[model samples]
Target: MITFYDILGIALAMSIDAFCVCICVGMKYNKPANYMRLGAAFGFFQFIMPVAGAYAGRLLMKYTGNIKYLAAAFLFYVAFHMFREAWKNKECKVYLSDPTVGVALLMLSLATSMDALGAGISLALWDGGIIWASCVIGIVCALMSFLGVFIGKRSRGYVGHYAEYFGAFILAVIGVRFVL
Candidate 1:
């Protein structure tokens, strides 16, 4: 059974990507409405992907027999990639001149929510409530994304980058916890 703490941790871990991208958007486009649009886009996708993944996971569960190990492995893989990205601190170009609500925002939202699909699969393996978990994930992501933009607008440099590292550590610990 997945506890509330576990769900919260996973949600936070998943939101890191959305948060980071929102920060970049915020830095480039400081419009208040743009922040809401970004948040809605990110949150909505984050909500949808997990539910889809959970359904897929349920379909596979009968054949797999045990999904805990798979979930742990997937979490570890996500954590590893997150850590790698944080270490590299790759430069991403955000077009300040471009419209905030269009293909670019849709693509960003889709990119960030991919991890939630994996997380949804993991949640299904753990017998988690996909709807509830997804709601929490969506709400948290929305709030984080909204806030990230403001933070980015106010600050410069790599101040918010540490969030990815922290999120990675949380995911890694959760993965190990599941294994043990």
Candidate 2:
């Protein structure tokens, strides 16, 4: 029987990606509202994905094993973009940096939540309810990502021009983790 502690631990573990990605976003922008928005996006994905995985785990896996690779590819692409932006002499572009908005937001949310999806597959076997666990995970992810953004924003000046580079490195590491 899974306990609340177990769920909390899982939530913390799963939120790392969102937190890291949010730190990246925070580096470029100091807006707290945007940080929450990014966190919400991640939280929403984290919430839905695990439920999807719990219900549709085996069914979906049969159709494709490339989900991990696809996620990794997206992360790597995003990371590469970040690295490029960091290297450029001009001001960083808005589209990629402001991941609180469109496709970039969705992709990052999906990529980061992949692990939560995997965790959900195991949740099917546990006596603990899926909804409650997913809720906790979502809330934790939102909070952590928000905190990451704040921290990143605070550290921006200290990091100087390399903030994007660090963020990109974090994303790349996350990508590599998804693959292996």
Candidate 3:
């Protein structure tokens, strides 16, 4: 069974991408509505993707043995992706006056929530309460994106950049927990 802290950690880990991307959006578009829309879009994606992945994971779970190992692999991949991005340390810029609409929004949301889907696969294999887990993840992501925008506008992307590493660390630890 997964603990509350585990869900929270996953949520935080899953959110860092959206948070980092929104920081870039915030740097350019300084509107409150943009922040909400970005957060909502990302949060909605983050909410739904994991649910979808968990159901998909359910199908895969039946054929698998020691599913925790598979779960850890997924989580570890997500963690590695984040860590790799952090190491690259490149500032991703959204060249738009309002990035909360149209293709940009959809692509960004999907990109960030990919990790959540992977996490859902891992969690679903172990726990039956994925809806709750996904919900917490969405809420935390929305809140983080909201704050990330504000921080970005104020700090010029300095503070927001390092968060990915911390989030990656959390995910890596959780992934380790799954196997051991």
Question: Best candidate, lDDT-wise?
Answer: 3
lDDT of 3: 0.85
Counted clashes in each candidate structure: 0, 0, 0
Best candidate per TM-score, number? 3
| Ranking 1 against 2 by lDDT, winner | 1
Q: Estimate each model's TM-score.
A: 0.94, 0.65, 0.95
Q: How much RMSD separates candidate 2 from the native structure? A: 7.5
| lDDT against the true structure, each candidate | 0.84, 0.69, 0.85
Model 3 weakest 10-residue run by lDDT: 90-99
- Across residues 127-164, which tens digit of lDDT does each residue of candidate 1 receive? 55689999999999999999888877876425556888
Residue 68 in candidate 1, Cα distance off native in Å: 0.7
| TM-score of predicted structure 3 | 0.95
Stretch of 10 with least lDDT, candidate 1: 90-99
Instruction: Give model 2's clash tally.
Output: 0
Give lDDT tens digits, candidate 2, residues 141-160: 98988887886677643332
In candidate 1, how many Å is residue 167 off?
1.0
Itemize residue pairs with steric clashes in candidate 3: none
